[model samples]
Target chain A: MQFVRAIVRPEKKDEVLENLSSGGFNAATVVDVVGRGKQKGIRMGDIYYDEIPKTLILVAIEDADTDKIVDIILRTAKTGTDGNFGDGKIFISPVEEAYTISKGTKGL
Target chain B: MKEIMAIVRMKRTGATKRALIEAGVAGFTAFKVTGRGKLLDHSEINVPCKEKLMGMAASDVIDRKESEEQVVTFLDDKRMFPRRMFTILAYDEDVPRIIEAIIKANRTERGAGDGKIFVTPVNNAVRVRTGESGDAAIW
Candidate 1:
């Protein structure tokens, strides 16, 4: 199974969750996150802030389902049209094994 | 416009999840994450990718799949799609201790694993049910 770690604009969470759920990947959890991008923190008028907040959406799916889920997330999350700074990032990685506590069995 | 999140590398979080809940992290999410960090901080991975090139270029791979373009598409079409993967989320103040607990739990099995923690800020938030604010939603 592949795992997705998405950092998106916090405001986009609703749309993201909606798309993910409507797309048949309903099981998800959202967390409040903070960090900065290559912009090395943002600078508005004159404030020098180092940390930035982001919403992290975490989910796991079968290999066959990776593409669809990614599409849904990107469509709903990617904000800047010209690749602006800190538009958020998505990380996909492999999961070695999974276990369901309620079922007490390994997930395939 | 601020969020508090932490990436804590832990050994297989069998019960650590439940522990997080008990610690007052009402609704939390977790994913099977892998890191080159302290090997002691490991989790059970279900699907393993033999060949992997992560970070910046990974995004480019998504945009370049179709059409006649040597440079590839700007936005990769397959980054967050299938809505499948490993991940978990929790509240702010709940992080430090929870991750600490996670690290402690991992340490029980492995010793002094190398790992780094990161925290980032969020711009806005919406609570699906009643449409609450970030602070009100979690705090």
Candidate 2:
């Protein structure tokens, strides 16, 4: 199994999640975080911030579902029409194992 | 000045997050992140290190900018299973509550294998559909 981490602009978080849930991949985890991407943070007016808040969406999927899941995330989080800074980013990683606590079983 | 992020340890994060929301947080993002700090198998160097794709997203009103900081909360589920990692992002106002709830959910004492929480600042946000501001766009 493969785990996908989508680091996207905070604004696009909802849209992404909505898409994921509707796309049949509703089982996952959500966390709020702060970090920067290639843009290395953002600048507004006279203010310069170092860290940018981002949403990390975590989901474990079958090896075959990896490509489609990533595609959906990108499509949902990508800039739609209005220009926006910090569009966000997504990363894929390996999950050593997964478990359902109530069941006390391991899924890898 | 620093990026805000969270590293939480728990199983079935979907449930933990639902609990946090009830505890009071605007909203959050999560990644399938993986990592080991204490019991991390330090024996292997290039042992194909595994890590979860962990991160979080937060936005604030233009006036409440100073409140942004790295929010860290730890959660623990003692079952002798593979440890899970998560990163949380939220405004400083809700850190205490989130931590409290996370601690409660993990069922940890002062400090166990639960996890840690951190926070940081966000640069800017704009609605992709209507060009709304970050706070307005996301929240």
Candidate 3:
């Protein structure tokens, strides 16, 4: 199993979630977090927003489905054709184990 | 690549950030978390004496019998303290320096609850905009 964590712009959250659901990956955990990327942050006329709000979507899927799910997020989360600075990034990691709480069953 | 997760006292977050930045870390994510360590401070359990509750002075309560003591009960004994968790993704070579920086910023003479540091292997990282992966993506 692979654990995919995507941090995307807040506005694109629903679109990304919808796309993921339609892609047959419905189970996910979403959290509202504030952080900066390589650009550090953005600066306006007289204000500097050091902590930009973003949405984190977490999903656990079969290793073979990694590329498919990543593609779904990359496509739906991008702002424009070429993408923007805050388009967000996706991270893939190995999942050692998973368990179903109610049923006490293991594996996802 | 490695992911360094440092949990430190909330008040030391700024110091930790500065330390990480000075150590040449590109970027990191931080969030507020509440957790408890293995060692619990008994003094915080809040077991008030009956004499104090009855309006008796401290000196008078010292001579009081143990039966007069009142122990407050609660649903749970554990207390969670607020902390700041910093998640930093960096190259393998940079892990040691980053960990040192985080420890220096948060460590104090006081023992325990100083927080902890966890290092985990990252399978891969992707830069969404450029479609870059591996070391090329992280920097």
TM-score of 2: 0.44
lDDT of 2 by residue, A14-103 (tens): 677667767777555556788766665667988877688887776777789999999898788878676366776667765433433222
* Candidate 3 residue-wise lDDT at A19: 79
Q: Tens digits of per-residue lDDT for model 3 on A26-57?
A: 55556678999888799898888889999887
Query: How many residue pairs clash per model?
Result: 46, 47, 0
**Cα lDDT tens digits for candidate 1, B18-102:** 6556666555455443322111112232112111212223455655433223222212222222211123344555555555554
Q: Evaluate residue B111 in candidate 1 and report its C-alpha lDDT on the 0 to 100 scale.
A: 25
**Candidate 2 Cα misplacement greater than 4 A, ranges:** A81-85, B1-139
Tens digit of lDDT per residue, candidate 1, span A36-76? 88878978889967788888877767789988898888777
Among all candidates shown, the one with the greatest lDDT? 3
Q: Model 2 over residues B30-68: C-alpha lDDT tens digits?
A: 654543222222323212221110122234335332322
DockQ of 3: 0.03
Q: What is the Cα-based lDDT of residue B115 in candidate 3?
A: 69
Ranking by lDDT: 3, 2, 1
Give the alpha-carbon lDDT of every model: 0.53, 0.54, 0.71
iRMSD in angstroms, per model:
14.4, 12.8, 13.0
| lDDT, residue A39, model 3 | 87
Off by over 4 Å in 1: A80-83, B1-139
DockQ of all candidate complexes: 0.04, 0.03, 0.03
